[model samples]
Target: MSDESSNEAPRTVRLDRELVRALAHPMRNRILGLLRVYGPQTATTLAGRLGVNTGATSYHLRQLAEAGLVIEDDSRGNARDRWWKAAHQGTEFDKAELLDQEPELALGFLHGVGQSYAENIFSFIDAVQTMPADWRDASVLSDYFFHLRADQLDAMMQEVLAVLEKYKTADLTAPLPEGAEQVTVQLQAFPRETR
Candidate 1:
């Protein structure tokens, strides 16, 4: 399947603990993030951009490829310079599936992901602050809070998932306005209070 088309709803695949462990590395996570954002890239290019040695990058790339997180772009030549892209546009892991067997590990992984995003947001804010006035004026950086009384957790989850699906399927190839650049949009939702 084409990488662009692979962005649709992902299949329900069993996520093994080994796969999660492979993804727990900071460099691998960053590599995945880069593949998702930049389409496809060669290990040499990734190594240069990430300031890591090509050998190390290639090793991690192989690990990710073995775990099915990334796939070689065979359409291009299978030469040493071949590029690799993410196998799936997104990934899903059932928390309940892991919680029963490895509650602590599952929770720890989730917490690390949350912290990574928090750090990323701060870095983005720092970059924004250093941009020219015109750029800052055209940018959007805001936080919103809402409180809702939900009758059922499942229904609430479905609603939020539906919204996310829309954004995930959005057409992003449209031409932007003059001088406009891509901006990161992060959406996070969780139970604020447990009753």
Candidate 2:
């Protein structure tokens, strides 16, 4: 099986109306996460890992392919069995566009993403206790209250993205530099409500 990230196409898709609808389900997001991180997998394998039956995994895989989020990896499985992988390294979209264009759909997508993110955060917390002290000390779960104008926040976000983009060309799964570890920086910024 080809599990190398370098071989896959670099794709970043902006979700449209249909794609957003296709991605609205929790199970689909979970499955996508597996494929995105683990590379090609069969329905039977995914079923075992996710604790779902093969039929359900297969069905959701078909739906995700319809939305162009994943694709069949014929090289990884025989005719009797099939394998799937994410078509893109990751997805990108404008949250503001979703809010302005389709509020209802935006709510559903945002809720789903929020749920997935919470699950991941908790999982990281669960594993932190077993990690080396150096890593644990470096990792932080923090929240900051900012009283900034919208433009200021946008500028701050752009600077953060610029820093992240410096490492975009490196293959994350490969051996890192002398002092580098894969770090996931999840950013969420929202304005506070008026009293």
Give candidate 2's error at residue 176 in angstroms.
6.7
**lDDT for each residue of candidate 2 in 43-84, tens digit (9 for 90 to 100):** 999999889999999999999998889999978788788989
| Candidate 1 overall lDDT versus native | 0.73
Best by lDDT: 2
Please, what are the lDDT tens digits per residue for candidate 1 over residues 1-195? 853496643433346677676677767877877777676889998999789999989999999998888888877656558798876565568878877777877776677667668877787788886898887787666755556655565577688778867755332334556776656666675567657
Error of 1 at 24 (Å): 1.9
| Model 2: residues with Cα > 4 Å off, grouped in runs | 1-10, 169-182
Candidate 2 to truth, TM: 0.86
In model 2, which range of ten residues has the least summed lDDT? 167-176
TM-score of 1: 0.70
Off-target runs (Cα >4 Å) in candidate 1 are 1-16, 130-161, 169-181, 192-195
Where does the lowest 10-residue lDDT sum fall in candidate 1? 167-176
> In candidate 1, how many Å is residue 94 off?
1.6
**Cα deviation of 166, candidate 2, in Å:** 1.8
